[model samples]
Target: MLVALDGVPVGSQDGTQLGTLIPVTHLRLPPASRMEFIVTGPSENVKSAQLITQAIVTGPNGDNDTARTLATLVAREEDDDSNVSRVPNVTGPPWTPRFAGLATAAVNTTRRLYFSENAAQTQFFITVAGQTPTVFSANNPPAVVTTQGSVEDWIIENRAQENHEFHFHQIHFLVRSQDNFAINGSQPVAAIQGQMMDMIEIPYWDGNPNHPYPSVTLRMDFRGPDVGDFVYHCHILNHEDQGMMAIIRVLPQP
Candidate 1:
């Protein structure tokens, strides 16, 4: 859970400080996702505060994560001379977005990928555009091949009834946009908008032919030095094990 400190959101899960603070009661966190928040202690006569997570219904067939208390906050006396120091107000210079350049960088390729599952939901597939959907296996060849130092925009659509988290190996990607997320009422909080992250949750599709499947557009950065076969998949272990994974081969720059 992304716990808001005093009901305010101040930073991104990727460690980038948000340009503006957004007030939110709580934020949903999928597996492998991270977030940073600043919680201020109560100034007045509040005895204690509890940090808790409400139950989350992942999907029709997904597990219902039970609500739990993460921690309890108790305010110390003002006159107490304990060594614990209070959290000070933020006073540094404004934060600069790490992937600011990617916002305008020309995208070398635009690709469409999608998630699907069998009728019984026993098997899953993450397939590339114009290819047969196949379960992931070590024997399978790289599903995607790209050259080093190239940037691509990937639109990942979730066609399943349950949510899935998209996780890329080796490099982080900027979240360019989320399609049909607001309509599903699961849009990301303002603080994480445009943030660079390795993993993000893709909400489920409602199976309506007229409505588009929920999708997230990411700007993949393959410019990093690492170049080899790496896999990207749904972070959910069960789904990945069933077959929602694929390999991307990044060859050395020409």
Candidate 2:
């Protein structure tokens, strides 16, 4: 059976067919990836259109080689304006994203720190990845970055079965040491990496050469003039709409 989603063929369960998945990256650049697969033969009348642009954290489903859904944090309704600008403050040492990656849960339902495969709990602030309610719950939550000239190690984890190009709005990073390991263990010192992206390309959770998991190591550089509240998330349109999105507020120069 062909799983035609939004007019685009994603995949089939029979293991005899393939579909086109759009990779939207750098919102300004549109779709920049094209994958050709031998699915029942390449016939005419096939639509030549792009689907998504950037990274969408997704995993493999039970019966198909295709993806499941976009990984994201729940968004507030259009009419809701109470917590939109909310900014939760951190008093102690800034919580390192690497440390958050170490948070654990008792069961699949447990969303104490990091998210699991379970959909319902994935939105919770499991390991501190993005700006979550628990992390930024105040009215007009201040930017996580403090004074200007602040540079930090931002980890773009490919937990989804796919890979992603995590593009940033103002900074361009360098490739440090692309690697992979248990993303949910207590190893704050352990390094996690992938290809360095001026625009971080986060592969989907289900992405792999033969089950691809392209983890890139990047060194993000942030300074003055470009410091402000800007978006730093996936470039895929549909996935961005789902919840694969976030904002980063860079402090101004002193």
What tens-digit string does per-residue lDDT give for candidate 2 at 1-254? 22222222333212233333334222222233222322242234443333433432243421122333333334333556765665356547633222111112111111111211235423322123443433223243443444445445544455554333455565544444444433421111111122223443433344344533335545555533576676544454434444444455666776
- lDDT assessment of candidate 1: 0.79
lDDT (10s digit) by residue, model 1, range 7-114:
223344344545445555677777877766656667678889998989876767576789999999887667666776776677787665445467668889999999
For candidate 2, the per-residue lDDT at 21 reads 38
Ten residues in sequence with the least summed lDDT for candidate 2: 105-114
Candidate 1, which segments miss by more than 4 Å at Cα? 1-23, 76-100
Cα lDDT, all candidates:
0.79, 0.38
Q: Return the TM-score for candidate 2, rounded to 2 decimals.
A: 0.41
RMSD of each: 4.5, 19.3
